[model samples]
Structures are given as structure tokens and as C-alpha cells.
Target: MEPKPATPLLNKETPIIQSKPNKKDFLNHLEAYLAKRDGVDKLLKISRYAAKIVLTSSALPETLTLTHRLMSFESSVGVSRKAFRLGKFVQDVNALRSSHFDSTEDVFLSIVAYGGEGVYFFVEQFVWLVKSGLIDKKHARRLGLMSAWAEFVGYLGSVSLKMRDLNRIKEEEKRVKMSIEVAITRGIKCEEEKERLGKLIEKKLMKRFSVVQDLADALMAVADIRDGKGHFLGPLSVSIAGLLSALISTHKNWVSC
Candidate 1:
């Protein structure tokens, strides 16, 4: 028999070159972001507050015109954002309808929060109309005051609910930690359980961040209800609070996107 031919050497595997994201990909991402009501609203909120922050800054007299333009832009964006929120509170109402709460207090808080938010959003439409000149400006102040009070009530309920939930999460975390410690002490191989507990802890930590967001929003609501009159909530202070709240909301929307 003829000697077997030597096997040919195999070619090295080719490296996969990932093409950089192009303008088309960027446009796709932009479309996705703009498609989301919350995403667009949050972006507008950030722009509005950022403009307000700049407008409130001490600047040369020559820059006054620019600041005035920024103020107009901020106001316009604010009204536009309200349009995005036209039916937003319906989400909360639906959540209340679908959710199963642990206690009567939870139920009550959810109802109050969702109900108040629903009212606020409904009233906000008229306020937006007034500001946009579609409705009489005489109704602006009344609608604004109503919306503010409704928002304040909603925030109060939301803050209370988040605090309660956070407390419960803390207790659960302690129990999980204790269980983990016991397992480790007993030389038990509970890798899966430990991993599960770790994931649970991470989720709880995210909820904590949500609590911070709600608190920031609550502060802004307080400023609105107070009409930004107090020293602690003057124009600059309100702008800063709004910026903080807008940043938090934008982060949340970005992550969700």
C-alpha cells in the first residue's frame, strides 16, 4: 500500500472583527430612545433643568439675551414634557389594579399615590394648554396650584410606600445574610444559594436607588407646592433640585431603555 498522505495542516481560526457602530446604528438607538415616552420626557426634563441652571447663574449683562432665550427654551421644553405625561399616571393606576400588596397600608398608599398622580396628570394637560395659549392664561395659576398639590400628595404616598418597602427589604437581607453565615460556618457548600442571595441583594440595592430617586422627586414636588418662595427653595435652589431629579429620572430611563 502507498504511504498515507500527510494530513494537511489546518488553517488558524480567523479573528472576528467587530465593525464599529455606524451612523445607522446610532440612528436606530436614537429612534428607540425617542419612541419611549418616559425616555423622551426624561431627556426634555434634563434639558429644561440644565437650561434653568444656566439661566440662574450670575452672568454679564451682555449675556442677558442669551439667558432669556434659555429661559424660553426651558419653559417650552417643560410644556412639551407635560404633553408626554398626558396619560402617564394611567400606568400607576394600572399598576394599582394589577398588583397584590402585602398589607392594607400598602393598598391604601398605592391608591392614594396612583389616584393623586392620575389627577395631577389630568390637570397638567389643562395647565399645558394654558401655557401654550390654547386656553385662557387666567386658568394657569389655578391649574398650576391644583397640579402641584396633587403631585405633592402623590409624592407623599410614594415616599411612604418606598420607605416601607425598603424596611422590608432590609429585614429580608438580614435574614439572608444570617442564613449565608450559618451555611459558611457549617462548612456547607451552598454556592447556588449564596449566588441567589447575592442576586437578591443586588436587586434590593437597586430598589434603594429608586428610593433616592423618589426622595429627590419629592423634594422637587415640595418646591412646586411652595411655589419656590422659601429661602431654602429659591429659584436657584429649585433649579438645582430639578436638575438632580431630572438626572435621576434620565438615568432610570436610560437603564430601562
Candidate 2:
């Protein structure tokens, strides 16, 4: 018999969602992931059989403030696994816990819908609505936007970043710029789509003498702002938003493919 062909199981498409060795110590982190999706019971069932993981206990405190935060982050839907990995949602509870609350969620949502995304950031604006001196810590959870939308947006953000990164290292010439533009304009869903976008952009912008990586960077920031909102416990409005201000002119330096 011919030797069996090697498996492609190690391919990058398959990301290993590892369970922390001490999950109990990181229940907050697990909760952040779980609260972002719909159907907890099903996810629980899935986790049970995925490489020696333990089911989470439901005995967490139910403060109304945090409850509201979780509700805000969660949607009535979930993202499909079939969707591409946007950015890797590293469940870094430590980052969240330790990162001083210097910024608001506005920094994440201004590019998409400004009002709701912005309002979520500034707690000072809501001081009158609360009793007194009660800071809400429930802002860490998030739910998807209408089934798989969260994952899709995340994938888009990550891909956009990759394209911007690729664009910075090329020269301004017909063919050279063409190739770089081609590689940078690819879609966010998968490798095939990214490659396809790259080719199309190259064909269109081959003669482009000027390119603005800053504008491209700003455009990428748009996705981060929009999708970052979904990472919150619920959909929110932001305050004090920043401009996606990138001034790209015809005279700027562009790359050649």
C-alpha cells in the first residue's frame, strides 16, 4: 500500500482554543468569552469535550450593574465558526483588570456609529443617572451583532491591519506599486479572498505614484472602532470620539507593485 498522505490538520485555518490550565482562576475571562455569544448551554456542551476542559460554575455574583453590562455585550445571536478569524480575541482578563481605566470605549467605536458607541465611554456623563459614586465594572462583556457579525468584523479589522503593514515596504513604480497595492487590498475573510483583493487593487492602482498609508491606517482604525464596540457587554453609545483623520493627497509617496 502507498504511504498515507500527511494530514493538513496543523494548517493555520484550525486555531486551537486552549483552556487555561487553571480555568477556575480565570472564570472572569471565560465569562467574558461566553457572555459574548448566544446559547450558553450549547457552548458549555462544546467546551466539555474540547480537550480536557471543565464546565464553569454558575455561582457568579449577579450585580445589576454587571448584569446590565453583560446584557449590553451579549446579543441574541452568535458568530459562525465558519467565519474567518478577524483579530485573535485573546481573553486577557489580566489586561482588562490591570489596565487603568484611562480611556473610554469611545476610542473603539467612533468610526462606525458615533453616538451610541461614544456614550459608552464616558461615565461622567451618566453621573446623574446613578445613585452616587458607584462605578460600573460590568463594561467588559460583549455580545455579537446578529449572528456571526462579531467574528466577521473582527476578521475584517485584522486583515485590514495586515494589508496596511504590507503596503509600507514597497516602491513607487508601475509594476512594483501594482503588486503592493494588489497584496494590500485583499478582503478580510480568508487567504483566497485576500489574494483576490490584492490582485484587483494592483490592476487598478499600478500607475499610482502617490499612496497614503496613513489614510489606509485610518480606514483600518474604522473597523477597530466599530468592532471594538461589539466586544463590550452590550451595544453602547460613546462620548468624546476621535476623528479618523488621515490626509492623503495625490502628492504623497505611494508604492509600486
Candidate 3:
């Protein structure tokens, strides 16, 4: 029989004594902690409130002729005007909230769900009206060609869908960063277009507006512990309390206003 080599002490296979916690379990625990502090509820409330405000402000911009016409019809309907408007607003809000919360990136959903979807809905109506000859060719041209409206809606839909998954959001951020880098190196040929894209990237692509800043702060503490830094529960508690304080202050300010 061939002689078997003895295993070196240093190189011997030692089973892992402990494995990392499941990610979903980790998230559930975090969510429970946050829920105790009312963090998750506040995120949902703020998202809906913010969406209502944005939807009203953007749904009837000067460029949307079709939406204006619809509003005119609603007004002419007399007794049903207020009810019609309220019903529509509620419907939009429900749809927006469903889509928004389904996404991992709540911040992006906060803005885009209300603002982007409002615009997209009008664009769809406008294109339909134009194609059906209900809108004059000259008026349609003034508002914007159907092709342009369709393209804009498509862009908004694509972005909204992409926000649903965290991996997709991160991938999109990488792609946007690369495009901007290429633009800088190659030099944008159209100054106007470059400025427009820059603003879109700044305002829509890069911005994250949400009430979860404290949760993120708590996460930093978790990261520090994972990195072998001494654990400090005080920081995490303070972060959670700070968000609650902020919410109270905001409510007071709004009431005063």
C-alpha cells in the first residue's frame, strides 16, 4: 500500500464555526427594529403625501394639451367635476403607490411615480387623441410630435421598471456614470443637449429623496461592527430617534405654514 501523507496542522480543513446570517433574515430584523421606532410607517406616509403634491403640480403642465382638454371636459361636466377630479387623483395615487413600494429604491419612486407617471399618462392620451384626429395636426405639433411624446413615455416606463430591483438600479447608476465619463472625455457635440442631459442626471438620476436617512446611518454602524470596530449601540439608537424627531418637527412646521 502507498504511504498516505499526513495533513499539515496549519493547512488542515477546519469547518467554519459560524456562517453569516441570511440576508433576508438580517433585513427582517432591521425592519423590525425600524418599525419599533416608526421608521417604516413614516416612509410609507411621506411617500404618499409627497406623491400627491407632485402629481397636482405636474399633471397639467403647459406642454400637455390633451390633459388640458380633459380638464376642460371635467369642468364642463358640472356636478361631476369635483368628484371626477378627486376620483382620478385617488386612482393615480393608488397605482403610483403600488408601483413605488414594490421597488427597492423608494427614494427614486417617490419622485418618479408621481411626476413621471403623471406625464406618461397624459402623453398616452395625447398620442391617442392625435392619432384619432381629435387633435389638430398644428396643435399636436405645438405640444410636441407624437413620436417625441411616445419616446418620452417609453423612457419614463423603462426607468420606473428599472427602479423595482436594487441590482438594476445599481447597474443603471454604473451605466449613467460611464456615459457621463465618456461625454466628458469625448466632448459633447451639442451644448444644448449636453446641458439637458446633465440636468436630468443631476435632478432625476442621482437624487434620492426619502425618510430613511437614519436607517442608512444605522447601517453604517452595522458596517463598522462588521469591520472589527468596537460595537456602539448608542449611535444606532440616536439615529433612529433623530428621524422620529425630524418627523415631529416637520409636522409642526407644516402646521405652522
Give me the candidate number with maximum TM-score: 1
- Cα lDDT tens digits, model 1, 104-202, are 988899888888888888898888788779999998878888998888888788878878877887887677666655665566765665565566666
CA lDDT of each prediction against the hidden true structure: 0.74, 0.31, 0.42
**Across residues 105-196, which tens digit of lDDT does each residue of candidate 3 receive?**
56554554454445544554554455456777666553444333433333354344444443555556466545544554555543443444
Best by lDDT: 1
Lowest lDDT 10-mer window, candidate 1? 8-17
Greater TM-score among 2 and 3 belongs to 3
Q: In candidate 3, which residue ranges exceed 4 Å CA deviation?
A: 1-92, 99-105, 145-164, 168-257
TM-scores for all candidates?
A: 0.82, 0.17, 0.24
Error of 3 at 234 (Å): 59
Q: Which portions of model 1 miss their true places by more than 4 Å? A: 1-31, 59-64
Quote model 2's TM-score: 0.17
lDDT for position 168 in model 3? 52
| Tens digit of per-residue lDDT, candidate 2, span 1-257 | 99766444323663323322333435665565455432243343233222111111223345546544443333211122211122212222232334342235422322222222222222212321221224343422222222123323333433443344345333222344344335444422244433443454553352232223333333333444466444321112111111111112211211110
Deviation of model 2 at 116, angstroms: 16
Give all candidate RMSDs, comma-separated.
12.0, 19.8, 24.0
Q: Worst 10-residue stretch by lDDT in candidate 2?
A: 237-246
